[model samples]
Target: MSPALDVRRPALAHAPLLADPVAAALQAWVHADGVGVAAIDPDLADTAAFVEAYGVASDASANCVVVGGRRDGVERIAACVVLATTRADVNGIVRRALDVRKASFLPMDRAVELTGMEYGGITPIGLPADWLLLVDEAVTLAGRVIVGSGLRRSKIEVPGADLARLPRATVVPGLGRPVG
Candidate 1:
C-alpha cells in the first residue's frame, strides 16, 4: 500500500479512472508485479495538492512534462519524467538532447491532443511510440513513484526500476535539477 493511499493491484482494475492509453499500457506491462493504482479526487490531481492532501513524500511523485523543439524545420518531441521536487532542464540538457535550436514546453492543447491525455495528467507510460521518453536517474532510484494515470481522478504507483524499462525510456542523469 502507498503511504496514504488505498493502492490496489492491476491498474487496469480501475479502468474508469485511467485514460485509454494508460489502461492499455498497464494491460501489457510485463513487469507489473509491483504496479498499483489509487483513486483520487480529480481536483487534487496536481502534484502539490495531492502531496499535501495525501501526505505522500514529494520525492515519491514524478511529473511527466512534454517538451518540443525544431531542428532544421523538423519537429522533435519528448516526454520528461522528473521528481516533483525538481524540474526538468529543458533549456539546457533537453535542448541539446533534442538537437534543436530551442526547447520549450509544448502548449497544453497540443500536448493533450498528441498524448490523448487530460491536461495535468500526462504520464510517460502510454506516450506515442515516436516520441522519446526521457526519465531522470533520480526517478529511477526513487523506489515507488506516483505518476498520473492519464486521468485527473487517479494515480499509478510503480517501482522506479519498472519505469526505466518502459518503451523508449532513456535514463538521463541530471535531467532534473532541484527547483528553487
Candidate 2:
C-alpha cells in the first residue's frame, strides 16, 4: 500500500458490513488477493469529499456505477468502474457492450437493494455473481487505485491489475471518456 493510504483501518473481514455476503466476498477477495484497505468517515464517503478531505488524488480514485437494461424481457445488469476523472459511457459503449437497446444507471433504490451495499459506497469487489463487471482499460493501467470498500466507512487501495483479475470482469478500452 502506498503512503497516501491510511493503514490504521481494520481489515476488510472486520468491517461491520461483512455480515452481508457481498461485502464478505469482497473481504475474502481482498485478503486472498492482497489488496489494502483504509478507514474513512462515512459522512465523507462521497468521492469528491473523500478526495478533498483526505488529499487523495482524484485520478487515483475510481468510481463504480451500476447500469441496467433489458433484452427480450430479461434484465441485464453490470457494474462499471472508471477513474474519477472519467465518466462511464453507459448510453453508448455500455449499451452496446451489454447487447441491450438502452443502458442507464440503475435506480438508486434498486441498486442499493440488489447489491446489498449503500448508495455512494458500491464497489466492484463483491458484486452479484451473475452480473457482469466492466473495468475501463485505463483503470487496469493505474498503478494503484482507491475504490469503495462495500461500505461508506472505508475504502480499498488496490493495484489496478488486481482489479482486472476479478472474476467476470472484462477490461474494455474506451469504457469511459474523460469528463469535461
Per-model TM-score, in order, reads: 0.95, 0.89
Cα lDDT tens digits, model 1, 13-127, are 6688789988787778787657788888888999999998888889999999999999889999999999999999999989988999899999999999999999888999889
Q: Weakest 10 consecutive residues, lDDT, candidate 2?
A: 1-10
Deviation from truth (RMSD, Å), model 1: 2.1
lDDT measured at residue 110 in model 1 versus the true structure, 0 to 100:
99
TM-score of 2: 0.89
Runs in model 2 lying further than 4 Å from the true structure: 1-5, 8-10, 17-19, 27-33
lDDT of 1 at 149: 83
Mark the 10 consecutive residues where model 1 has the least summed lDDT: 1-10
Clashing pairs in 1: none
Best by lDDT: 1
RMSD, every candidate, angstroms: 2.1, 3.1
Q: What stretches of model 1 exceed 4 Å from their correct place?
A: 1-4
